[model samples]
Target chain A: MVDHVGLLSAFGLIDAGYRQAVQVMEEGGLDGSTSDPDFLVATGSEELRADIPVLRHDGKLNPNGRHMAQQPIELILLKQWASYLALPVWLIDDSGNLLYYNEPAEALLGVRFEEAGEINADQLAEHFHTTRLDGKPYPNAELPIVVALVGRVPSHDTVRVRGLDGVWRILAITAFPVEGQGGRHLGAVAMFWETHDS
Target chain B: MKVTLWGTRGSLASGGPDTVQYGGDTAAVELRGPAGEFVVLDAGSGIRPIGEQTPSGTKRVDILLTHLHMDHIQGLGFFSPLFDPEIEVHVWGPGSTTLGLRERLTRYLSPPLFPVMLRDLPDVTLHEIRPPASFALGSLTVRAELITHPGPTMGYRIESPECVLAYLPDHEPALGVAEFPDVPDWTSGFELAHGVDVLIHDAQYTDDEYKSRVGWGHSTFDHALAFAALASVKQLVTFHHDPGHSDEMLDRAMAEMSESHDLEFELVPGRVGLTTCVD
Candidate 1:
């Protein structure tokens, strides 16, 4: 079995809540009268084994490991496997800062993960030239990503944005808040598909 | 449905001469059902008045509390209906994962906080409720949505065949760093109050007070008015008057306000005993 301690800390999942959750995971599980079961571990405790080599490789590739420490364990799992998905994935912390995006998402943003270290929610909107799907005015606060982070509820909306190629892409996005135990918000993730005119 | 503003003062109870006109009870409102069923909102000090007004033969009533803040629930013990065996009051409120509504209410309803225990109230049934859920309250379709607040807070929309009335007694619709994890954005408030005939909302601050008190989970009169206008609600009742605000101060908040030519809607500062019919 992987050393849960080394794996969690190595991934830079270093928030106080995450640490407290790990402590519970070590002592026992909340299913059996665990004290102060604050956070829920999205990933199981089985780690360090050669079978789960992807997490190890991702930890090595994490440019923002120091920053990832602030994210919840569930978010860490998203960071690890989100890039592998065929769909473009965008992740933001509970505070609504752009934490990371998959390669496909980066291609859409026309920026790179390494090049753009951290961007606030507002700055990302300005960079993308986001607008309402209806071609009407859209407020920064009402962005699907912002709604997901602020409302802590799953939201789906279509937005028109000027992509890097100077083409207006109509993207249908569904965003849901990442939460730990007791409904504590971890962050939010957005999955999107760009509709093209044939 | 007929609505009565039994308690309008916000934060704390202040019963004095200055508050006589608006009355100094904290958040409680009662909606007399069209078919004689009882539906009440919150249990603040205003519940005492409801308990007194309730007739003994009233068989069933549902109390949907917005949250468990002290000011919102301090009058529960004083509410006499819980002691009567004849009335079956079903209490519903938002609950955390670790605690249900009844368990969390023990914080104030138990020995240390009050003499009576929830267990003693055989007539009262506490149900742990979450929002984004809708349930039928007799003929009225009641919808509850999680709103922006410090704890697990909720706002409600009550609809009848005749008209729709949305009540958000304790809410801060403005966006800021939220304390709770899943608290919805300000748009949720607009959605709840949208297209309703009467929107009774928290107007607990002035524009000046709201500056320093931003993110405190309360709204100013301007915020309340703006929401009522945006939602296109027919009438707005500025509720949850600040405890420090006297009847005179409340009068000025509404008296100075006028309906713009572009936006025509009736605005009234809420007062205890003022009844508004949802028609």
Candidate 2:
């Protein structure tokens, strides 16, 4: 068994917080050893993990470890992966429900995911005012997230979005459908960065 | 409401002496309401003849495409009204995550595929539809809903003042399930087809053929009948015939199905140029 903790630590990927979490996990009788790095990434106990971002392995996450009986593992992994991303990331379900947006995304949207919760596709359209580069109001049908949710394809476009702060920001957005094992459409994820002002 | 089947064949256009009785065109169906609403269900090769026979003084025609599969949209460029600047041609298709309707259609309508680009076409407008959406074309109200298919495909429910007609030419309502018509609410395309006056649905394979081609996004006659029964549709017009099945084969299959099954609704084999008035 390759010690994942020592390996990730050797690569300088683990910080002080991650080391402490690992120490606590080891103290709690987890054995804290696995041949596969990904297995170690996926099976962390909830209380020990806390808010510390853990990299996913082979598209699996078990925040509640083997006890995760509810949400799909793929989504849990994606949410964790997104949380660690410095770039703004938004995760939506197959039905177009807003599932999660990371801390970086919350800064840009001017709201937190906990407060916003799961916004349905229809309400999402009303929440953000989007416009095309030519200043025409962007049709909901053309939005990258809408396209990704409906068409199940990767889409990229530049549009202006009005944040909750009432400021319009030009963002070059790329959204792609996330399909799980056996070609199941898990949902879609969108990552956008602020571009030049409109 | 008057419904006309211009093309009944599915997959590919299999025109030959063997297909003469049933017609070899792909899926283009035309619907007209008493209030003068003209709608084309798909742009399959069958659409060519319908375009040739377009009524004079027709101002606008809405082409509601279920999906962008080649057999479905093959007759689009050949549709004459797209060339007429005097008429407005609206092509409504299922939206994709990758490209807009115009861009996706352009791949087929332009360059090495075809001579004229979708952009070069006159009086042609592209409309992207996200299913479970309701819209109106004149007096006819149309409800588009996403169904179980390979891509972003939709089944349409068109309701007029007199009658309701549902069209789901390419659907697999029993993809994952072991026993079909599991639950009314859980069945794919159930709501669009439920209790409609007429349902034109996919019957692309026989039961045995479907076993080998599961998840191919087409329904077997048994599956279609089950769907129709669950929806309580008054008349079920079997559509999207497999390209390999000859007229004689289809006739024999239809006969076998009718003889073997105790069905509740009227069943009719879809044939090109068959017209029905639902009242």
**Residue pairs in steric clash, candidate 2?**
A147-B97, A151-B96, A151-B97
* Residue-by-residue lDDT tens digits, candidate 2, A1-198: 014334333433335555565556566644323232212112123342342223221333222132211233346446656867899999887656567788889977788876875555555644678899888977655678755654556899999888777888899999998875323466789999998965
Residue B152 CA displacement from its true place in model 2, Å: 0.7
Per residue, candidate 1 scores C-alpha lDDT tens digits across A44-99 of 22231112122121122223243221233345446655857888998887655677
> Which 10 successive residues of model 1 chain A have the least lDDT summed?
A48-57
DockQ, candidate 1, vs. native dimer:
0.05
Q: Can you give the TM-score per candidate against the true fold?
A: 0.63, 0.61
Candidate 1 stretches with Cα past 4 Å from truth are A1-177, A180-187, A190-198, B177-186, B259-262
> What DockQ, between 0 and 1, does each candidate earn?
0.05, 0.02
Q: Give the alpha carbon lDDT tens digit for every residue of B15-93 in model 2.
A: 9999987889999999988888889999999999888888889999999999999999999999999998888998888
How many angstroms is residue A193 displaced in model 2 relative to the true structure, after the best TM-score fit? 34
- Native interface contact recovery, model 2: 0.00
Chain B TM-score for candidate 2:
0.98
Following a full C-alpha superposition, what root-mean-square deviation does model 1 have from the true structure?
15.7
